[model samples]
Target: MREFDYERAADAAHAVATVHADPDAVFLGAGTNLVDHLKLGITAPGRLVDVSRLPFDEVTERPDGTVRVGAAVRNADLAAHPLIRARYPMLSAALLAGASPQLRNLATTGGNLLQRTRCVYFQDPTVPCNKREPGSGCSAIGGFDREHAVLGASPECIATHPSDMAVAMAALGATVRVLGADGEREIPVVDLHRLPGTAPERDTVLHHGDLITAVDLPALGWATRSTYRKVRDRASYAFALVSVAAALDLDDGVVRDARIAFGGVAHKPWRAFAAEDALRGAAATEENFGAAADAELAAARPQRQNAFKIPLARAVLVATLRDLAGQEAR
Candidate 1:
């Protein structure tokens, strides 16, 4: 690892200002991802601004029934919080499904969102990865692509975002609050992550000096009936091959509303807007659900080894919606 200077940020403003002052400075939250990158020689920032001690660690309930989760709130604490377990069961379940107990205990909300992809090529500094080194070309595109993305993937990159919490947030319609050098601003969770277009290096829309303050989850009564389903290579401590976070509101066997997001499938949490659009006002049946899932995966372009992901994603979506419908029926 490269030697670097360290600075302890007193608060969010100080963190932002400190990063703004140094072009190569990076804010350190839980240090789970940053530390790993440093050891792997993936990132060697000149200065490390520790923001874990900042005031952004509280989980508060708003007057309007919305939940405000500070960026530094630990994943385990967020999952076990009474309000989160009671109201946002999907979010809680998503958090529990990720990593292990020890890592979740140390991983913060913002840090989890900012976590990098687990692509082998990207992790190996010797290999060429567009996300790691721009214009160097993406080795995953023609290499071992079983874990790569099928949706929203450009020819330059096919890496998938690895975050269970992000999929839940995308489905729940959460908002991200950030403190930048200019001031504060809010970004929707769906818009927070960027698709791998011509510029595949940029994972998110955050500015250089932006410090995430909190995540605001709006009141969604239907989320009480939501669930998260993940399929992976292993039973535990494995990233999703294709995961679904779904919330459905049914009225007498007809869909009233729906929120769906898929993980391990795209550059970001892949929001199934087309599927949701097809599900709304449609009969809550397996056939209808299959059609909706098909509509969403219609644009999926899979590689040779990972072509099975398209069918797997479709089945997962159908099964998840069917299971939710059964729950609603009961």
Candidate 2:
């Protein structure tokens, strides 16, 4: 809605330079989320650096078996890539379980990672949303908050980060490669996103001019036996009420290692590090799985209306681990 200058980036360097030169400039990948925010009046950038045609659209497998996913790669292509489907099935499943086919075809990997929360108040300009205007206050805290966050929530904000791909990547221990005016850097997926502490306005740790070029997924051999389970209000085209991305490495009915992350329950992708720690060397049984889930969710602080998310998250975690354990048995 706001008048802005648009520039097509020649390359990654050009894009980063353009954004760095202009304080009110943002990179344009697929424009799936950015455009919506523009129309909603949530963001009004002075310039839009088009990075859709940048040389970052390939999905390649590295020599060490790790996967390198370009930020400009389409979500559908990433989901259907052979390496992703065969080796990192959890990542593929998470992508497909996200938006519909048309949106997925248009959404880019980087854009998906940078997607904002779907909190109703945050979208409405009239409401008080700390994410939109820090210090104004968070209406979701006491309003209709069934979809708000239950973990890592602050009084300033209770909004959840709505990205299924990031959740799976967190479970896979992926690292995001970024380029900026200074140089290039690799930020762990877990560290890329930030909690809604005092500064709920800042969603990620990225600098103003940082450009995410690619996402490097470490070799997750056990992820082949992984699963992404999402429980939403509807069957399709809906955000997760509680989702689980889990991978279990089992050895003779005992857990050798585990990677677990939860969505729709936290400010960012909630990595179940405690749960994985508890599962290691433990018997692959329902009781043990439940215990691990409990251990990870022990610090969950649910709100008045969204307290159901706690039990829902626990159930999803237990079910996902059980399903993966079953696959290992087969």
lDDT of 1 by residue, 238-271 (tens): 9999999999999999999999999999999999
Provide TM-scores for the models. 0.98, 0.98
Candidate 2: residue 211 Cα off by (Å): 0.2
Quality of model 2 by C-alpha lDDT: 0.92
Candidate RMSDs in Å, in order, are 1.5, 1.6
Off by over 4 Å in 2: 327-330
lDDT of 2 by residue, 1-330 (tens): 579999999988989988998999999999999888999998999999999998899998899988899999999999999989998889999999998999999999998999999999999999899999999999997799999888899999999999999999999999999998999999999999999999999999999889999999998787899989999989788999999999999999999999999999988998999999999999999889989999999999988898899888888888888888883322
